[model samples]
Target: MAEAFERGGQQAWFHDHGHWGVFFHTYDNFQLSGFGEHFDQPRKIHVFIPRDYEVSPDRYSVLYCNDGDDIFFGDGETEQSWQVAEKLSQLYLRDQLKKIIVVAICSGDRHYEYSHIPEDDGGLEEYSRYLAKGLKPFIDENYRTIPHSTVILGASRGGLAAFYTACKHPRQFPQVATLSPSFWLGLDSPSYSMSNLDKAFKIKLQNSALMFALTSTLLEPDLRPKIYLDWGLRDDPGNEYEIRSQCRCMEMIQVLTTEFDYQEDHNLFIVEDPNGSHSINSWGDRLPNILQLFFD
Candidate 1:
């Protein structure tokens, strides 16, 4: 049997495989032209709604994830993904997670879209606006989502974008998860060394905008969003481009804890996986834990 629903420009198909079911939808050619000049391109939005969605009257929480294609399909290069739909089904069946809707936004020019530093072309601001102003409202209006229960999540450069977007619009996205964010983008590092710690720390200190964001959260603790951050200890400096990812992740933790006064395992949780790496497989393995932190 087949059933379907449509809302605004979005459409969903109910797939029942006897034992279980899932609602898959595609928002094809989702345009970002109204948000900013830099975001004139169109992107696809892949949404997953649980099988019981149509019959259940309960509103669901929303998880907006970046790198939509990779989150579901496993980046073609790595042959791995968060396997979000499969994981969600398992958790729902086990009653470990509350019913939640997941939306993954495909990326266009990832570096330009995710970076905080403005390339001569564009930067995080345009992308944040697209999420906060453009895409979010559409989802809210079309789906049965609790207003304050929404969370935004991403990994790597996309992770940086997730945090940055939440920081910019805490009222819109009050909860965020970042998996190994590329926080070293605005700094310069020729090589990694134990000696580079002080230098790297100093460079991050000079990031006035980042400092202000963290400090502002401290100043108004009540309005601060719950945050989840994770980094793999095994994300070694052996990789040339990511040599600073681990160091910067530590710096981010330090600033959030010391400067922002975000308590560990409280409103803020940071997980360091001794065996983790900078790969989707690693992030996928940690998704269950991450979702529990956000939804539980």
Candidate 2:
């Protein structure tokens, strides 16, 4: 049910001199078969350890992300990545954040599993198991990672998956950051992805909020895990009347808080990039700050 694959020795599109000490390992969740027979490349996941890791080789926090191919690394030049490796490299050098391990789990037929739909593959627990259960243990064994200090992250569509991952498995990944989650994927009209987020946090917070921390499994009675939500307000090229309503998303979240009765101040944060748009550059510019607020 668990195996480690490798994309070793292949030409990398985003690997550059500045991305020093970066080592990658390929992984796949081939056992995860939702589409049945038609599914290919099932066990594909990537582990990205920073250059600093070799020198320190100490236990570090782990951040798991979706969109494995494009987030931490890219498939080709035109498919530019989020450049997180370099960004973290600079930050680590300047001491903006501590060194951490980033595990990117690729999404095969992501549209199905990344969604909440019951019938589709996105809810494919097989892939999730390979990461949260199988692959993660492998990472813990090989790399110097804090027993659990695992943080789950995702952007755009990946964002929604990150949140869902945290919500369902609060004990494993207590802290989560979603940068413009593609919540709109499974939602209906008059309600967007933001609506889904509203329900998740409001209804799902544990008592201790310390689930993601290495030492904690339960959020304190009044305690809650740090949650970060970032969204930009800009006219999406594809959607006309559907320009992302960042403000409305915030409003919906706030309303959910009141209705759900969770700690308003401690549970959630909605950061707005007022002048920002929807793009890697936009999300990248704010990644470090979000890390500080949530994972630091």
Candidate 3:
């Protein structure tokens, strides 16, 4: 209710406060925030501060996500936005779920940023820097964030970025959730569109190898984040790969888990939703669990 902040902050539910001064933040002087030569000017980042920040006098966990364009809405949400704010509010009513401040930093390059094909170094490292070095510090200084409980999440390429960032910089983010990641990225070739399906498969397979190889270092003893990944096998309407994505997802999960096992303390999970697909709606299903992972 009260159309929390702006439409982009659709899910934010202010506590019993009268809801007078909830401000929707934009890239106002984000450039002046002490970033060195290593940082790039962000297109824009929307910051949502819950109304209770002052009255409650408690530190709230921070949830950072990609694809802000459709994640929040007062109405007319594309049936996929997390609907997280709404769900959590209801849960908060029933029991003891902690409140949180969600920082939805959006981007249009869903594929270019999430996928490794176009990124200089799988796009994960730079993106991780943007968050750990730039965004995360800004939040810590400007807002009260639970340093150890902070989370990063996404779907599709955003999911890939979330997973990559957590693995690459475990100390920065202790929790992560990614749903229906288009692991198909870096693999989708122009040839796939040109009807050369076999060649496309080859390209994806090759890229997948490289991507996983890079993630191997993430599980090193010193850096390990609690990770959650889920996917739907029967997506794409009529997938012709026979035992394609499902089997592949399983295999990849196995790989990641094996690596995590080597670490002394790492919690990694893979939930397979039989009827899920690569979409926002699918990710929304895990909203409750995702929140509890860090907030609770």
* Most accurate candidate by lDDT: 1
Query: lDDT per residue, candidate 2, 88-166, as tens digits?
Result: 7778778778777788776667676676545444454444444566556666776788855888888766776776666
Please give the RMSD to the true structure for each candidate, in Å.
3.0, 7.4, 5.8
Q: In candidate 3, what are the lDDT values of residues 4-57, reduced to their tens digit? A: 343222223333323232334444224423443434544556566665566766
True-vs-predicted CA distance for residue 28, candidate 3, Å: 6.7
lDDT of 1 at 116: 67
The lDDT values for all models are 0.76, 0.60, 0.61
- How close is every model to the real structure, measured as TM-score? 0.87, 0.72, 0.75
Off-target runs (Cα >4 Å) in candidate 3 are 1-39, 74-80, 118-122, 188-216, 235-247, 259-266
Sequence-dependent TM-score of model 2: 0.72
In angstroms, how far off is 144's CA in candidate 2?
Answer: 1.5
Return model 1's CA RMSD, one decimal.
3.0
Model 2 regions lying over 4 Å from their true place: 1-18, 28-41, 55-57, 76-78, 119-127, 189-225, 236-242, 245-248
Judging by lDDT, tell me the better candidate of 2 and 3. 3
